[model samples]
Target chain A: EPEVTQTPSHQVTQMGQEVILRCVPISNHLYFYWYRQILGQKVEFLVSFYNNEISEKSEIFDDQFSVERPDGSNFTLKIRSTKLEDSAMYFCASSGQGVTYEQYFGPGTRLTVT
Target chain B: AQRVTQPEKLLSVFKGAPVELKCNYSYSGSPELFWYVQYSRQRLQLLLRHISRESIKGFTADLNKGETSFHLKKPFAQEEDSAMYYCALSGRGSARQLTFGSGTQLTVLP
Candidate 1:
């Protein structure tokens, strides 16, 4: 089965530095999403992207966050200035055009901020 | 506001025992409920959806709109059933993002 793939399974970055978490969603999916889980916490939605624009975003997705589908396969979540609170495991997900609600998640990327 | 609540943080049962993982939700309109699971070191994946009314891995969940609950149940628990379970809810409107419960850790001892 095709699965969503995320790069840099683990990353450590300094506070205030810019970081980008990349994801390659399922090839045929039309909707992409980003979610984060602070250690021991429930996964929280960050944003969803479709049609080269953000379809929805949570309050946690503030000015520091931006998402882009730089190419056909790459969906990225960039944080302009990382904060300590930003340290968490980020998951990428995708689903077919009509059934986007049923998302398939990737093996999250663990981001640690120092 | 919409929310999902899984009261129990952890549950442990012996093999061959029946298991129940509770889940409750708060939503006004018709809600779509799902139970997702994550095995150790693995990605979160869908275990079953209330809409399908199907069982997966001996697990089943029934959506009770009146009580606003979708509790997962398994007739005979197996050791391999140990994992993290999350209950999620989606509203009827557009762009209905899922709201998940805190999750329950189920451990089926051998």
Candidate 2:
């Protein structure tokens, strides 16, 4: 079965630095999303991207966060300035164009900001 | 606002015993509910969806709109059933975005 793939399974960055977490969603999927989970916390939605634009975003996805589909398969989330609280497991998910289609999740990238 | 609640942080059951993972949601509009499981070292994957109304790997979940719950259940649990299960919800307006619960870690002891 085809699955979503993410790069840099784990990353360590300094505070105030920028980091990009990349994901290659299933080839045929049309909608992409980004979610994060702080250690011991529930998964939180960050943003959703479709048609090269952001569909919705949460308060956590503030000015420092941005998502881009620079290529057909690549969906990238960039944090302009990383903070200690920004450390978490970031997951990328994608789904087909139907309302009932379940979103497939990637292995997730663990971001650690010191 | 849409929210998912999985009250149990951990549940342990012996093999061959029945297992039930509770999930409740709060959403004004109709919402889509799903159960995702993640085994150790594996990525989170969809286990079942309420709309399908089908069983997967001997597990089934019924969407109780009156109770606003979609609890997952299996009649007989196996050792392989040990994993972290999350209850998620997607509202009509934000179908692509999912709000997940804190998750329940089920351990099926042999």
Candidate 3:
């Protein structure tokens, strides 16, 4: 079975620096999403992408956050000027066009902004 | 606006015993509920959804609109059932982004 894959399972970066987390969603899926889980907190949705544009986003997705499908297979979440509160485990997920609600998640990338 | 609540932060059950993970939601409109499970060091996977009304891996959940609950139940718990379970809700229309509850970590002892 195909699975969503993410790069740099663990990322440690200095505060105020820009970081881009990468994900390769399962091929043929149409919808892609980014969610984050802070320590001991529930997973929160950040943004959703479809048709090469953002379909929806949460309040947590502020001006500092941006998502792009730079290529056919890669979905990237870039955080400009990271803050300490931004430290969390970021997960990438995708679902096929047929079942938009059934999302398959990638092993999360743990980001620590020092 | 939309929120999911899993009251119990942690639960424990012996192998062969029954287990229940409680979940409640607050939504004005008809809600779409789902249960996602994360095994140790693994990604979150869909266990089941209320719309499907199907049982997966010996687990089942029924959505009760009156009570606004979608509690996950298992008749016989196995040791492998130990994992973190999250209850999520999706709103109507195209976005369908999930709003998850604080997960319940279940430990099934052998």
Candidate 4:
């Protein structure tokens, strides 16, 4: 079974610094999403990307956050200026074109903004 | 707005014991429900979806539309069932992004 893959399993950065999390979704998948879970909190949806544009985003996805599918296989999330509250486990997920509801998740990247 | 609530923060049961994790949602329109499980150091994996109505790894969940609840149940939970379970909901049509609950940490003791 093909699985979503993320790079830099753990990231530590100073407050106000920029950070970018990278993911490579499963081949042939079209719908991509970004979610985050603060320690001991529920997983919160950030944004969803499809056809090279943002399909939907939650209120939590503010101007500081941006997502890009720079290449055919690579999807990335960039935080312009990190805050301490931004520290969380960031997960990348994807689903096939037909079955967009069934998402496959990557082993999240743990971001720590100190 | 959409919201998912998993009432139990933690639950434990001995091996082979029946287990249930409660979930409720607040959505105006028709919604799709799903249960995702995450084991130690593993990525979140889909356990079951309300639309499918199929059992996976001895677990089943029935969506009660009237009550706006979709609770996960297992007749006999094994030790390997210990994991964090999240109940998620998504609205139909274009807005399909998931809204997840706080998640329940289930420990199946041996």
Worst 10 residues of 4 chain B by lDDT: B89-98
In terms of lDDT, model 4 sits at: 0.94
Write candidate 3's Cα lDDT for B1-110 as tens digits.
99899999999999999999999999989989999999999999999999999999999999999899999999999999999999999988687889999999999999
Estimate, for each residue in A1-114, the C-alpha lDDT of model 4 and write its tens digit: 899999899999999999999999998888999999999899999999999999999999999999999979999999999999999999999987655559999999999998
DockQ of all models, two decimals each: 0.72, 0.79, 0.94, 0.85
User: Please, what is the TM-score per model?
Assistant: 0.97, 0.98, 0.98, 0.98
Weakest ten-residue segment in model 2 chain B by summed lDDT:
B90-99
Candidates in order, interface RMSD in Å: 1.1, 1.2, 0.5, 0.9
Best by DockQ: 3
Off by over 4 Å in 3: none
Best candidate (score: lDDT): 3
Clashing pairs in 3: none
Encode model 1's per-residue lDDT on B1-110: one tens digit a residue.
Answer: 88899999999999999999999999877899999999999999999998899999999999988898999999999999999999998677455567889999999999
Write down the worst ten-residue block by lDDT for model 3 chain B.
Answer: B89-98
lDDT tens digits by residue: candidate 2, A1-114: 999999899999999999999999999988899999999999999999988899999999999999999978899999999999999999999999865367999999999999
Q: What level of docking quality does candidate 1 show? A: medium
Compose the digit string of candidate 3's lDDT tens values, residues A11-31: 999999999999999998899
User: Residue B80's C-alpha lDDT in candidate 4?
Assistant: 97
